[model samples]
Target: MRVLVTGGAGFIGSNFALRARERRPEWQLTVIDAMTYAANRASLEPVLTTGEVALVEGNIADAALVDGLVADHDVVVHFAAESHNDNSLDSPWPFVESNVVGTFTLLEAIRRHGKRLHHISTDEVYGDLELDDPARFTEQTPVNPSSPYSATKASADLLVRAWIRSFGIEATVSNCSNNYGPRQHVEKFIPRQITGILQGVRPKLYGSGLNVRDWIHVDDHNDAVIAILEQGRLGETYLIGADGERNNLEIVRMLLELMGKPADWFDHVDDRPGHDLRYAIDSTKLRRETDWQPRYGDLHAGLAQTIDWYRTNESWWREAKVAAERTYERLGR
Candidate 1:
C-alpha cells in the first residue's frame, strides 16, 4: 500500500508514521507537513533516516501539491492542523486556514482522485459535558464547539461528511480524546506542566484545575485510527478513547508525585476563556466494530513512561520550551 500521511511531523501524526512503519513494513509511506511551530522533524528521524518514509515539507491547503500527492497515493491519513487551543484563541485566522481551508483542499483532492481518506479530528468538537454528567461523547454527538480551534475542526468534519454524501467520497472520520505522550508540544497541558517542573518552575494550573479531559496514549489513538482507516465502513464516524478520564488537578498531582515533588507544589493561574468543564468519550462502537483496544490503559504507568521520554530527550524539547515559557510568561498563563 502507498500511504500519504498529512501532518506527519507533529505529535500524534509523527507517532502514527513511526507506528505505521513498524506495523506495515511493506507499505510505502510519504509525509506532507507544513512544519509549523508544533511540528518537530526529529520525531520522524527514525523512519526518514531508514528511507522507510518520504517527507514533503508543504501545506495541505496547497491544492496543486495535495492533488498530485493524493493522486499517487492509495489513501490519505489527514492529521495536519493548527491544533493548539490557546494559539487558536490568541489568533483564529491560522486555525481557519489550516483546519477549515486545509481540509477542504484535501477533500477536493480525494474527490478528484477517488482516493480513500481518513480524517483525524478531536472530541472537543462535541463540546464539554457537565462534570457530574454520566454522558460521554459518542459518534452521534452533535457538534457544539465553544472555541475557535474546535469550531474550525468541527467545520472540517462537516465538510468531510458533506463530501462523503454529496460526492460519494470514500472517507471515515474519528474524533479522539486528549492525547499525551512523547513528541507532544510543550504548550499543551500535560507537557507544559511536565516541562515546567523540569525547568524549576512550579506547575501552573488554570482556575481550580477541576476541568476534566479524557486522555489516551498517542500509540493507542493512532492504533484506533489505523483500524478505522483499514476496516471501518465508509461515511462512518468513530469515537476513539481509552476511558482515561481525569481532572486537571489529578493529572498535576500525579505528575508532581511522579517527578518526586509534593502534590501541592503547583500554582494557580487565571483560567482560559470559555474553558470546557469536562470532556469524555464513549468509544464502544469503535471497539465493537474494529475489535480494537488500548494497550496503555493505565494512565499512571503511561504517564511515567512519557515522563521518561521527556527526561531523556531534553534536547528534543529544550529549544521549544524556552520560547513556549516566554510566551506563557507574557500571557501570564
Candidate 2:
C-alpha cells in the first residue's frame, strides 16, 4: 500500500511516520512537509535513509502539488497545520492559509481521486471545560474554539464533515488531546520545560500555572489514528486520549523534582490572552470501537523518557531552542 503523510517532519507526524514504517515495512510511505520553523527534517532521517520513506518539501496549500500527491497514494494522513497557539496569536493569517485553505485543497484532491483520508485534529476545537466541570469533550461535543489555531481546525473539521455527507468522501477525523513525547517542538509545554532545565534556564509558567490539559503520549495518539484508518467506519469522528489529566503546576513541579531541582525553581509570567481554563477528552468511543489502548498511560514515566530524548539528542533541538527562546524572551512570555 502507498501512503501520503502530510506534515511528516513535524513532531506528531514524524512519530507517526516512524511507527508506521516499523509496523508496516511493506508499505510505501511518502511524507510531504512544509518544513516550517517547528519542523525538523532530522526526525525522519532513520526511515528516509533506509529508503522506506520519501520526503517532499512543499506547502499543502499548493493545490496542484496536493492533487498529484493524493492521486498516487491510496491513503492520505492529513497532519499538516499551523498548530502553535502562541504563533497563531502573533500571526493568524498563516493559520487560516495552512489549516483552512490547506485542508480544503487536500479534501478536494481526495474527493477527486476517491482516496481514503484520516484527518488529525485537536481537542481544543471543543474549546475548554471549566475547571470544576465534571464533563469531558467527546465526539458529540460542540465546537467552540477559542484560539485562531483551533478556529481554523474547527473549520477544517466542518469541511470534512460536509464533504463526507454531501459528496460521499471516505474519511475519518480524530481529535486528540495535548500530546507529549519525543520529537515535540521545544515551543510546546513539556519540551520547553524539559529543554529549559537541560540548558540551566529556569522554566517559565504562565499565569497561576493551574490551567489543566488532558495529555496523551504521541505513540498512543498515533496508534489510535492507525486504528481509525484500518477499522473506523466512514464519516465517523473519534476522540483520542489517555486518561492523563494534569494541571500546569503539577507538571512543572514534577519536572523539577525529576531533574533534581526545587518545585519553586520556575518563573511565572503573564498569561496569554483568552487562555482556556482546562481541556479534557472522552475517548470511550475510540477505545470501545477499536482494540486500541495506550501503553504509556503514566505521565511521569512518559515524561522521563521524553526528557531523556531531549538530553541525549541535543544537536537535534539545540538550534530550535535558541530561536524559540529568543522569540519567547521578546514576547516576555
Candidate 3:
C-alpha cells in the first residue's frame, strides 16, 4: 500500500508514520509536511535514513501539489492543520488557510482520484462542556467551536461530510481528545510544562487551572486512526479517547510531584481568550466497532515516559523551546 501522510513531520503525524512503517514494512510511505515551526524533521530521521519513508516539504493548501500526491497514494491520512489554540487566537488566518482551504483542496483531490481519506480532527470542534455535565462528547455531538483553531477544524469536518454525501467521496473522520506523547511541539501544553521544568523554569498555568481535558496518548490516537482507515464505514465519524480526563491543575500538580518539585511550584498566568472550560470524549463507538485499545492507559506513566523522551532527546526540541518561550514571554503567558 502507498500511503500519503500530511503533516508527517509534526508530533502525532510523525508517530503515526513511525508506527505505520513498523507495522507494515512492505508498504511505501510518503510524508508531506510544511516544515512549520512545530514540525521537527529530526523526528522522521530514522525512517528517512532507512529509505522506508519519503519526506516532501510543502503546503497542503497548494492545490497542484496536493492533487499530485493524492493521485499517487492509495490512502491519504490528512493531519495537516494550524492546531495551536493560542497561536490561532493570535492569528486566525493561517488556521483558515490550512484547516479549511487545505481540507477543501484534499477533498477535491480525493474526489477526482477516488482514493481513500481519513481526516484527523479534534474534540475541541464540539466545544466545551460544563464541568458538571455528566455527558461526554460522542460522535453525535454537534459542533460548537469556541476558538478559531476549532472553528476551522469544524469547518473542515463539515466540508468533508458535504463531500461524502454530495460527491460520494470515500472518507472517514475521527475527532480525538487531547494527545500527549513524544515528538510533540514545545508550544503545546504538556511539552511546554515538561520542558520548562527541565530547564529549571517554573511551569505556568492559565486561569484557575481547573479546565478539564480528556487526554490520550499520541500512539493510541494514531492506532485508532489506522483502525478507522482500515475498518470504519464510509461517511461515519468516530471519537477517539482513552478515558483519561484530568483538569489542568491536577496535571500540573502531578508533573511537579514527578519532577521532584512541590505541588505549588508553578505560576498562574492570564488565560487566553475564549478558553473552553472542559472537554471529554466518549469513544464507545470506536472501541465497539474496531478491535482497538489504548496501551498507555496510565496518565502518570505516559507523562513520565514523555518527560524521559524530552530529557534524552534534547537536541530535537531545544531550539524550538527557546523560540516558543520567547513568544510566550512576549505574550506574558
Best by lDDT: 1
User: Candidate 2 versus the native: TM-score?
Assistant: 0.99
- Residue-wise lDDT of candidate 3 within 34-104, one digit each (tens)? 99898888999999998989999999999999999999999999999999998898889999999999999
Better of 2 and 3 by lDDT: 2
Q: Compared with the true structure, what per-residue lDDT tens digits does model 1 show for residues 1-333?
A: 999999999999999999998888888999999998999999999989989999999999999999999999999999999998888888899999999999999999999989999999999999999999999999988999999999999999999999999999999999999999999999899998888888878999999999999999999999899888878999999999999999999999999999999999999999999899999999999999996899998999999999999999999999999899898878778
Higher-scoring candidate on lDDT, 1 or 3: 1
Q: How much lDDT does candidate 2 score?
A: 0.94
Displacement of residue 245 (Cα, Å) in model 2 is 0.5
Off by over 4 Å in 3: none
The clash numbers for all candidates, in the given order, read 0, 0, 0
| Models ranked on lDDT | 1, 2, 3
lDDT of each structure?
0.94, 0.94, 0.93
- Show the lowest summed lDDT stretch of 10 residues, model 2: 19-28
